[model samples]
Target chain A: MKLKLTTLALGAVMAAGPVMADLVFPSLSYRTGPYAAGGIPFADGYADYFTLLNERDGGIGGVMTKLIECETGYNTEKGVECYESTKGEGALVYQPLSTGITYQLIPKVTADNIPLHTMGYGRTSAANGEVFSNVFNYPANYWNGASGVVNYLLESNGGDLKGKKIALVYHNSAYGKEPIRTLEELSAKHGFELMALPVDHPGQEQKSQWLQIRRERPDFVTMWGWGVMNQVAIQEAANIRFPMENFIGVWWSGAEHDVMSAGDAADGYKALTFHNVGRDFPVFHHIQKYVVDTGKAAGAGDQIGTVLYNRGMYAAMLAAEAAKTAQGIHGTADINAAMMRDGMEALEINEAKMADLGMPNFGPSFNVSCENHGGPGLVGVTQWDASSKTWSLISDFKPTDGDVIGALVAEDSGAYAAENKITPNCN
Target chain B: MPDQFLFATEVFINGLMAGVLYALVALGFVLIYKASGIFNYAQGVMALFAAMTLVGIMNGQVPFSHIINAVFGTEIHHFGWHVPAFLAIILTVGVMVGFAWLVQRLVMRHLVGQEPIILFMATIGLAYFLEGVSDLMWGSEIKKLDVGLPQGGSFWIEDMTAGLGSENFYGFFIDNLDMVATIVAALLVVGLVLFSQYTKQGRAMRAVADDHQAALSVGISLNFIWVLVWSVAGFVALVAGIMWGTKSGVQFSLSLIALKALPVLMLGGFTSIPGAIVGGLIIGVGEKMFEFWIGPLVGGATENWFAYVLALLFLVFRPQGLFGEKIIERV
Candidate 1:
């Protein structure tokens, strides 16, 4: 009784008071915007996974998970507002899900001692853990995705691309431009002629670019598009009779909405994937039983299993596993932001662990270390079977060329470090 | 060089097609401005809302499903009854007509004597309000709008133009949807011209555009005419929305395409229907052909600025647009 009284007195003396019982995770969501088609599924997936964990396992290590989503509408300013307001609620980590918002929160989260997870996007150089210690983009980054696409292409072409002409049609934004330098480097190394074509923002019109494609007749054409841009590009490619087999896109361009409109013409259109495409995983059964079946879902219950929805689940799995890892390191279930950051650094999710978690092969299995925020960048290519309206994995989970991409990562992170006067304390 | 010119010809042809679409949206602006003297900036958002409503009604989905779920704590989405395309379109036109009436009653009724600049700002605000309401009603997910329009390239056109280019060159590529949009847009133009010239209501609208005071004095109820014009604009918005929402999935960017109509209005006089079409064609074809010829020479992506640059240059030479009334300013 005397010890409890002493603790209560100490807690009363402090203004902020006692630590919360729940682990806080702030989701920067954009459910209403120009990119709402893409954003809605991802947000639903993220929220549903956390809810599933809470409903099934009672959260990570028996602590209730608290997800307070403040809508960003995919705008950078609104993202910052959500961050500023929610960071004080003991937010252990943040996933902005937007490249522009991720960049804005990177510096602020560092100062606030919070970890920012950009996942597959934002600045590609954030893969270097030393310069971006407080941020993590584990499993993959844009450069890794770019190399993975090229590697799949190389393997498909029987390992030689000496005189192949490759064209990259990308969105005119930082998200789209992230892969250009890496693609250029790969082009030089492989002796493939690279042509970069940019479609303006929102990209509703693409007559000239496709006309150029008709004229140039590039051997391979890759795309970096989102929302309506992807569907329009697919339709245009079919219009020009461009072989869907030779046409590919990054992960963002692959989803149900993109292909459903193009109908049968989208057959054989390929894209990169960091996780399994279908809802074959055991975790989904629980999501159906606990969340959708219970009518506790955030969006349409039918959208429980989709491309971007699965991606959200993959991201939440990473975050939850990192929390478990952080709790193991700190020897306490009541983990804070700093503890979660260290936990993310030491986190690992192998095949066995995923199997144990009831989501065998649902996502890429990788280990995060102090020097590398982005884990082994393994991505597979998936093709759309328009008739059946499904995407099937066309390639094994292939690792990107670390030697070429790593050197670029170092050069970029080094430049960023110098510009920001950051000291690298990487082990 | 000869091969380059061959590609250039295709580019020019494609641009004219794109311009037809731009003109299609511009027609909505011309219809409303000529009758009411109010520049309707919400025309693009109106197109998106109409498409979303059409999709929702066709799918038998509930209106304000998101809001209802939030407020009532109940989960109800679709009614599980599919609507035929023709009936759904008719229902959507009715909804748009109701929206026109609401605008006439609630907002425009209050601001009847406001300046043109004020009215323009009001329309801008209306755009935001309409966008938000549509999102709330239909839920802002990207929806696939299929009214059974033919998609993909026309093989007949390709075969016809196959021998026109070198054997190495592929045949000319043309989307069947774009062809439909062009033919429909041409019919709309003809229908509008006939209505405006032959119908007494059209002559009354023309008189209003000529002089509002005189039109009001000449036994015309300005309120009724305004309502008629807005309903007509809403119909035009529906057509533009169908063409655009079909081309690109019905989403938020559909509204931004309305901005393209502004420069069209600048190129063609805002008050002239013919000018809107001509201006839209000029801007559309001009940007595409310019991007084709000079884009690579200057590293590409000139389409964004080329239309505005053309409009700016043309405006510098003539303060009044090509078909605008000559201004007589008194010092």
Candidate 2:
């Protein structure tokens, strides 16, 4: 009893000191693995953005934001370890780029009052406003990405999604399963037939998959793959005489590295673009002027404006915006987790402000709320042109079906909570 | 039922194409195993590295841009010395030869009398080390390897009555590259058979293959034979890499497919050239056919296990393999 009393007294004393002014980030980076092709650039871009913030803006609100990188290597266990290790250092938010890790950490982040930003991945149902309170998949979910691609195909084939056969060749994982629930729903609603093809992980050999495609002859094929698998799928599809324009990839499937692997054959392949593209934007210009030109950039020259880099920059933008909002509420950037949560829900990136911020193609502005974690589901389609070695935006932002997503989010978040054995904080 | 049969035929032809690709990979394994008992597990990695080098050189991503510029009197990013396709192919073959020579000198020479398993483990180590080294050299991003193979199928086989069926059964289409690979593989097989039968060096290699001890006792320099065999294996691996790299764009996972050749070796005799080619074709065609007929019934990923399962069954019936010499040990 005397020892317990002494321990309690020490804890109380420790709690009395002023919390250190720090913004800790739990980086879910995969630097060494198959997915490292995608993961390395993303981590580098995320890290560089934080470093730029510290150097250019004198930190977020004059208090430095510490970017703590704990490599997940794209494994779920390492992601949890990184989260647990960084949460104690006063973590502001967690952005697990992996769907598996996002599902694992949702309950923990919610219970611990740390919001997770799962951009373009994770539980498609998490896009529901009421079901997922602390989790946000802004820009769009997989379903939104799928819808954007389907819509692009519809527009290309004379502007209608009725009575079409859409095939989905996907890696058979949770990441691959994400768009299916939504795509099936869309198929049912729009009178389109959906053919699902599952490719096991590391999708290297896919001749049979392409042969099946040749036999079935689906009107369009959208792929959900990463790393070498993406290139292999494109190559196989090309070999089978599949029309390149009809093949659409998810945001993950659409990278310069992925296209480069297929060379000129992947010229007309289209994919969903959630954020700005090309290095001509003002923010990119700033990065070039301040970071690259001044020798502060972390990546190679050829890697600039790639898919992963833009995703990382967007993630950094969200974090800084949340910090700015938290400063507005708490009157300091060195706010606690609760303040960060509040800031995350209250951010408003208007179109005019986005343009002023040097992002002209920065989709739509959105704001989250206490009950609604995911902001607006807006997406645009982009296509690669091999001759120029650049991606050109082919469509404007189209609003995704939020109602459909809300129902899924409700069903999925409940499933996620139950599977992981956690209570929902819906109350 | 008719549609299913047509689909089955379609799947079979498709499998043959896939088999050709797998055979190309297995040929590399057979060539190395025939020359040296050690299975060069890093053949797939060698292919990936070779393809990466090709793409890197073509795209001006290689360093020495200033030197290339100085030599040509113009600033070039990569080896901006765009030689013709045949020259590029020749240079790649040279690279593989150099790689083989280096490996023979640095790694194989030291493990002369070591256990076979130890050498195999060394190759595995070499595989990972090469993967890391390749990534570091060529930036771990996915790159396109376009050796200017024909893109899509050209000739449309429309005469349905020409086959062993009715008007509904049309001749299947073939990609131009697939046809080229099949032709090239056939030519290489014939060329290699003639070389092994006709040339003195080829006879020396066969002597080495027959029995390393006898070959050594008959005044044959073991080191020279070993290096020669490795160089030949390296040539085979380079050709296999170019074909497969042309097919799949030569990323890191392509090396993983090299592991699939193990089961092929088990089905074919480990040391038989014809066994490797035929075994690769059988495994390839068998897996594709099985996946087509029964894949959807069992979670639709039978492509991953079908080849291994087929080889396992063959092992059950024929313990020494189809072409492997049956062992008769005397105590």
lDDT of 1 by residue, B1-331 (tens): 2556667777777887888888888888988887777889999999899988898998999999878987898778889999998999999999999999889888887888899888889899999999999988988777778898887778997888777767765667777888899898889889888988999988887887778789889898777778878888888888888888887778888887887787888888777878888888899889998898789898787887898899888799876677766669799
Runs in model 2 deviating more than 4 A are A1-22, A31-33, A70-91, A107-114, A128-134, A150-162, A261-265, A335-339, A419-423, B1-4, B58-77, B156-171, B328-331
What does the lDDT read for residue B120 in candidate 1? 89
The sequence of per-residue lDDT tens digits that candidate 2 reaches over residues A1-427 is 9999999999987785434766776677887667887897788778777877777777788888787788897889988998887787777888878998998997788789888888888877675545566777776788788777766777677877787899899998889877888889888777789988888777877777877787778889999998778888998887766888889999899888788766777889988878867777778777766676665566553466887888888788888888789889888767877788778777877788778767776657787766566677788888999999898888877887766666777787777667757565545
Among the numbered candidates, top DockQ falls to 1
Chain A vs. native, model 1, TM-score: 0.95
> Considering just chain B, what TM-score does every model have?
0.96, 0.88
Residue A400, candidate 1: alpha-carbon lDDT: 97
The local lDDT score (0 to 100) that residue B234 gets in candidate 2 is 61
